[model samples]
Target: MEIEVAIAGGHGKIGLLLGKLLVEQGHTVLGLIRNPDQEDDLHAIGVEPVLCDLEADDDVGEAVAGVDAVVFAAGAGAGSGVERKRTMDLGGAVKLIEAAREKGIGRYVIVSSMGAADPPAEGGDAFGEYLRAKAAADRALVESGLDYTIVRPGMLTDEPPTGRVEIGSRVERAEVPRADVAAVLAAVLVAPNTIGETFELISGETPIGDAVAAL
Candidate 1:
């Protein structure tokens, strides 16, 4: 089943990899980017570029107007402070949901962090604030009545893909490669059983495809 998918924060590591995986799997991938410079990057990976800012786009529906599914992969960078975290992480996902409903797109996936569900007490730190934003976004998406899956991966790394993973409600604290994460996202997009589930991901012995199948 081929589908047209829109990826928010299309230039990010995980997002770009996910888009490329989708493209390789014969799915049309539209990457939403705010910078013109990022256009070439997406093109090189076979992902069509759609110019839009999750934070600044007045009508996000226009960006995802024709997509069959939407993946929220946008986030404030490591250097970002607390404000951008809310605007980009929390607010951006919320707006994406609205756009999904307006565009009549039912399939949605969110790339979140492992601790987002039960973040540490607000310690007045940027990381703490990020968790809060993610939790809120996940909550809203689940209650939005959309077919959504929240993938909470443990500490992400730039390591090469191990082609193995562990996926369930909770996984041991471990690092998973960005490539493995992308592979999981691609599978979840096509696997109907993954809908309405929020799972944690980590590196394990099970193959990526098998892990997703067990979802």
Candidate 2:
């Protein structure tokens, strides 16, 4: 089924890969980007670029209106401080959720971190703050009553996709390629069974499709 998908943080590594994959699959993809310079990048992959800053926008519903699904793939990025973690990671996700609800879009997917569910108590650094923010965002999505799937991937690498993964309610921490994470996110979008299912992702022997199907 061909559908329109709006991706927040569309210029991110995983988001760009996912957009290309979706476009190749005959789906219309809209990439919500904050930088005008990134428009051509999104267009190069056949994704329509919508300029909207997740942090500054009060109502993003207009940006996502008419899309069949929405994906929250934004982050505060590495080296970011605690405040950016709260505002961008958590706040950005909250904005997307509200926009999705306002537009009456049901399918919502978010890329989260592995330790979000149980962040370290002793660490008061940026990474710890990131986990807590993600946890809060996950909670909001779960309670939003939308058809949402939270994908918590392990340490992300830039390696090529393996096309195989291990997914479960909770899995051991390990490295998974950003390409493979994109593949898993694409699969989750099309799999109705994945709705309301939150799982940890990592490199495994199981094919991406089979792994998602088994979920």
Candidate 3:
């Protein structure tokens, strides 16, 4: 089943690969990017780019206008400060949820981090702050009355795609490749059983195909 899906921050590491995979799978992928210059890259990869700043946008409701599903994959990457972490991670997520609600779009997915359910103690580090923000956003989305899935992945690596994965209520202690993360997101997009369930995933030396099948 091909769906018109909008990927917020579709140019990031995991987000970019997910957009490519979705496009290859015959899904209409609209990438929401902050930089206009990023559109060319998306176009080259067959993703239609929609320019919007998640932090400052007041019209996200219109931006997502006709899409069937929404994937919130945007985040403040490493080395970012606390402000950016909150703005893009938590605040931006909440804003997008409101936009989805106003537009009447029900299917939503959030790319989150492991341990988000239990944030680290304050004054820890930037990554700690990020987890707390992601947790807040995940909780908010679950209560928003939208059909949503929150994917909490462990430390992300850049290894090539490994088809095998483990999916459960909590994946707190493992490292998963970004390619596998993208694959999981793509699978969830079409898997009816995964809807409304927050899942944690990690690669386990199995083929990506077999891993998805196991899910």
Candidate 4:
């Protein structure tokens, strides 16, 4: 089934890759990006770009209005402060959730991080805050009553995709390429069984389709 998918943080590495894949699969993809300069990049991959800052936009319903599904892939980068973690990581997700609900869009997928379930102590550190933010966002999505899937990936690398992965409710910590993560996200969107399932992702011997199907 070809569906329209709206991806928040659409210019991010994984988002771009996912958009390209979706478009190649004959799905209409709308990439929500904060910077207008990134529009061409999205267009280059056949993803229509919607300019809207997740942090500043109070009402993002317009961005997701007619999409069949929504994906929250935004984050506060490594150099960001603690407050940005709260606002961007957590708050941005909240905004997207609210918008999805208001638009009556049921399918939602969030790209979360490992260790978000049990984050380290909040010692005024940025990384700790980021994990806590992801945890809170995950909680919100679970309780939102939407058809949601939370994918928590281990350390991300920029290497080429391996097309294989290990997915489970809990998995040992390891690294996976961003391309593989994007492949997993695309698979999850089309797999109805993945709805309401949250899992950890990492490099493994299992093919991506089989891994997601087994989920």
Candidate lDDT scores, in order, read 0.93, 0.94, 0.87, 0.94
Model 2, which residues run further than 4 Å from truth? 121-123
In model 2, what lDDT does residue 126 have?
93
- Kindly give the stretch of ten consecutive residues in candidate 1 with the minimal lDDT sum: 115-124
lDDT tens string, model 1, 71-97? Answer: 998898889999998999999999999
Per-model TM-score on C-alpha atoms: 0.98, 0.98, 0.94, 0.98
Q: What's the CA RMSD for each of the models?
A: 0.9, 0.9, 1.6, 0.8
Clashing pairs in 1: none
Per-residue lDDT for 4 in model 1?
Answer: 98
Which pairs clash inside model 3?
Answer: 163-207, 163-208, 164-206, 164-207
Q: List the residue pairs that clash in candidate 2.
A: none
Global CA lDDT computed for model 1 = 0.93
Q: Which tens-of-lDDT digit does each residue in 61-129 have in candidate 4?
A: 998899999999888888899999999999999999999999999999999999887998667488889
Model 3 scores worst on lDDT over the 10 consecutive residues at 206-215
Stretches of model 4 off by over 4 angstroms after superposition: none
TM-score of 3: 0.94
